[model samples]
Target: MQAVRGVLAVFVLALVGIVSGGKMISDFPKLSVQQMCELMPADTSFLRPHTCNYWVRCPANNTSLEEGTCAAGLNYNKDLGRCTMAANVDCPYSKDSISTTDNLCANETDGTFLADNSSNDCKGYILCKARRENKSNCPNNLIFNPTTRSCVYTNQYRCPVNGAKTKSPACLSLPNNTRLANDEHCEKYYICVDDILYERECSDQSAYDVVLGRCVSALNATCYSTAKLPPPENTFCTSMGKPKVGYFADDESCSHYYICGDTVNGKHDTNPQHLQCGQGLYFDYEKLSCRERLNVRCTLDRCADTSLTYVNVLGDCQAYARCSGGATVGSGRCPADYYFDERSQGCTPVNHNYVACAA
Candidate 1:
């Protein structure tokens, strides 16, 4: 009877264990089919009968497979899982779209072509279709020159010059419309166009004033090596021989322009005009001048670079803290009667006197 009882008791315990195990399994949430596929091995390759093999670029070191698609100017190749030029695709060809020739790109029209797909983690090449046939791995410092049909150095290059014994200074190529000073001649400067340098002489034989960055009579020329300066309205002592009255802008509010009045005891009296946009209003640069602060577009990354004073929604020039890498760095504020200059990134007193803006 005891043996019979023991067997019955074991059977009852086993039944209880089975029932609890089933409940635990049902309690766990199940993943969907898509999730299951994604969780599979990364470098997975499979085949469909009579079709191309499918592959996920799950290299051992890669954490995830890259998105599969060709760039806008390229066509995808299903067999190799790569992208090629529009003309290289094996699909239906459009005769009008491209002109194919075996002349090694010499007869090809002027354009740019990519040799391989860049969307994936694979190397690629850029080909130039120019009068002279050439191929290159256009690195960061080099760009393809269509005119020459070759890759040329960007920052450094040898300008073509006629035969002369005295070599010319290594001409620094600049963008079009950019002006640069000519160290050799004070009455002339240089401008760049089409990666070619052109010398420009000041009209009337005037000297190029470095401070003003323009041509002026030699007698009136005052060169400044740096661009940082007080307001353009402020007359340089060397130019006027004395301080003069005019409105100048500091690093602060535009509505609050500064005025430099007659010199007092050989010192210019710089004072603020104390212009007001309202109690909560701050000045804003609408275009070149200041108005009430408005909702101007700004990126968070740039706005956080340094401490700044900006017009809030309520129009007050409130202090903002500096940030580094999206983290706060420090905080600061301008003194009374002074505003922060966004250009110079410094606090400037409103103009009421002629003390130097730096002072």
Candidate 2:
């Protein structure tokens, strides 16, 4: 009994030493592992929340359990179900489940995470600013990707931002039969139909409409410009496997263009410099510069045939569409003084300033 009392006295000294050090006992990170490891049922192995190096296994009928730490330079990946190199696994967080939503920020430092609410788990997220909760919802066509920490296309990320909300309350409350712009590549977009995501790419390099959520010319649509366009190899400025230095126009949008080389040194930059012209100016790809938007023309399937050079705009005499290599590039409308001679063509006065002819 005296030996036991001596051991207890040592423990009390250690406790006093820790308490006197000025940090609360609860402030130690291992306290969570200690508390949760003991509470888990025997014979179960589990990961400690928010940590990548520590894992705990409950021993049979034992009150105490020891946490196992991963070897040096390795992190635990729950998806791989094992510990591996940090490169092999993406350790966004060690555990998929978060604390109860009532206090989503509980035990969480100053950071943001998915709200993943039970009743409406589609697009909500909670931001932890100054350790205070600021809950907000993503737009109707988007869903929160906890991994990316951004609101993405509804079809790109299946709803239920976190795993806790998945299949728990039947399913997510995401919008059905909706269109969403791909946040990465301007050429790609998505459609969510009946809770399933369908990925799509534009036939041409058209940008997805930000507001209407449909394919529109880059000149017209506000494509999500987050640097995910086709690489330089596939872009218009690429030649002999290297990007050339110049201003390159987007295929569809008259207003948007990109600068492909260094401005200061004339050396080529790694990525094409995406840019936009003023509101009314369109990028003239052939002239390799921006010009006033005047005669760009378009109609349903008017420029489908590559063999045709000019197609008259139906019903409109002033507007015509210019097709080159089977795609409409600009408007072929005659100048105000010179009307399109239908013996020449009747232009619809749409999306074009003809590069082939003077304005």
Candidate 3:
């Protein structure tokens, strides 16, 4: 009887072990909160613990198995496990947790971005188009400096005016019909019109009268030099007493006649007299009077030596007078069209026909 009972006990223990193993396998926990939190389902709506776990409670609300639980906490919905907020509502995922797209930019178009896909959203993630920061869009005749991020105009052609090939940022017209060239620098061709100075483009020389100071056809236009000369024919003459006779003077003698010192009229006369001429004048023995020598005071007719001319293009007179025929005038010659032919040494017009006398 003792052997039979021991054997029966062993058989009973083996059967109990089999039953316990089967039960443990069937009653195993379906899911844990830690596992549910980490699982990312294909459909966010299926993220509830009821769907994912066989035995665990809801992970989001910590509810029992009977009450559905959301995995996304307060952001979660019973039907949709994913977190979402109503339009214009503040949300944790947003920059300001708001349903607006204001803080984000959209990625579209070169060098451009969009803040929102739909106009309804005031704020969202912005998308931006990627571009090289160093790229530029400068055209010819314009240089772009990356460091400055500015386009600079250049004068590579060395033109006198309007030479810049690039279009001007601002169009500027010449004031008072001013002349200009095709160079970068606007060269001015100025003329006196109706007593008023006017400027024009240098290339439009034909459209202006340089002499009349008016706008006229450039064809056959008279080009004038800035030079001027004083009037002609005003003079003074004084005779140095007939060749000093014997280089002495006598009170009783009508005119003291000295030894022949100089020749006059091919005669060995004892009179050693010399003739004295005033400024702008030379003695004319035939007339026995001083006459104007145009070449004497006129810069145009004066000697070719540039230093002798009284005035230059800039209208400045030389500091000293010009010497001619071994005689020195007290003052320099007047500019072209002006004359100082008289003993007064004042400047006057060369001819009323060509130029009006200046006051």
Candidate 4:
């Protein structure tokens, strides 16, 4: 029917998140929306993979899809096609290579490599194993093939997004521990435990006070800045600085949570009033209400530039942190009889994979 629907065109990259004459871009142009609309085949829109601020149009012939947002503070810049602002919006879902703190496979003298088509995309491909750095792709939608290395079929491969040096996660579909604010590296921040989305930083490195979401003193962090904006429309409480009244959580859904009252003058209702959690139940930020669904696990958070991994410290048991690729670096304490132990990285009295920091 339209060539078997073109499978949503796979990942139609034209390349351009804005940078026109200065021309430095370095590949930047992603557009996955991964898999939504289930199967549209209508007027065709598709630009919601990782996120620019939400979208999924599709009308003309209509197969549904609808769901769009991009205005307050703005973002959605599919290369000037719309919304734009927040420096010019780069975010297409982050990670287009550039991680190297040494060890992206040392020098690779042993098996399946792939990233050098300037850097990435041929559907990813890193492997390695012992030295670490997994980063693989090309499963079915196929695209690897660095001269018969593997994966096939494609109008020359797709996936490539770097949202200005990574920092787009406020932990989608929030409601776990939920604490966020890394508008784009104001020293780093983001938690959501149980819902996932780790990526923290700023123990003394300072700067990330998006109105008390934590970390301070980069001259008092007005929201520091390494420049490269556009990853903040946070909207769960707008980065939640003045929020206090009662329950809060739900940036997209965890069955739902959010409710504030009073403080009409000091300003702290970053869009309040949200509820829902009783049909099979869900919301449970420390038993604030609703339950079940394995006691509410939710889900969201990502890391992969090579991702080493290890997290827990949002509420603290003794402490734990370490994530290498995608950043979080250093953090671990556990002394009194030992604690933090993911097998071997230090701190251990036995208790490995983390059970909410053991606290």
Question: What digit string (tens of lDDT, one per residue) describes model 4 on residues 50-147?
Answer: 55566555444325547688878886654344566756765545454223123455666555455533223355455554554444344456566566
TM-score, one value per model: 0.16, 0.25, 0.13, 0.18
Give candidate 2 misplaced runs (Cα > 4 Å): 1-241, 263-271, 278-280, 292-359
**Cand. 2 TM to true fold:** 0.25
Residue runs of model 4 more than 4 Å from their true location after superposition? 1-10, 13-22, 25-227, 230-359
Question: Where does candidate 2 have its weakest 10-residue lDDT segment?
Answer: 166-175
Task: Give candidate 1's whole-model lDDT.
Answer: 0.37
**Candidate 3 vs 4: which has more lDDT:** 4
**Order of quality (TM-score):** 2, 4, 1, 3
Q: By summed lDDT, which 10 consecutive residues of candidate 3 come out lowest?
A: 166-175
lDDT of 1 by residue, 1-359 (tens): 77446544543443343222212111111223222222223342211111112212323333554434456666544344466675675421234312221223355565544332211111122333344322223433443333553334543334343342211111111113334444334565544343233457776437666534567875675432321222233333222565655554334432344445667777555453444344322344334344323333222222322233431111223343454553445656677776554444555774322111112
Total clashes for model 3: 52
Cα lDDT of model 2 by residue, 55-124, tens digit: 6655655455666778999876543446789778654342443232134565577755545453255665
- lDDT, model 3, position 251: 21
Best by the TM-score measure = 2
Per-candidate local distance difference test: 0.37, 0.50, 0.29, 0.47
Order of the predicted models by lDDT, top scorer first: 2, 4, 1, 3
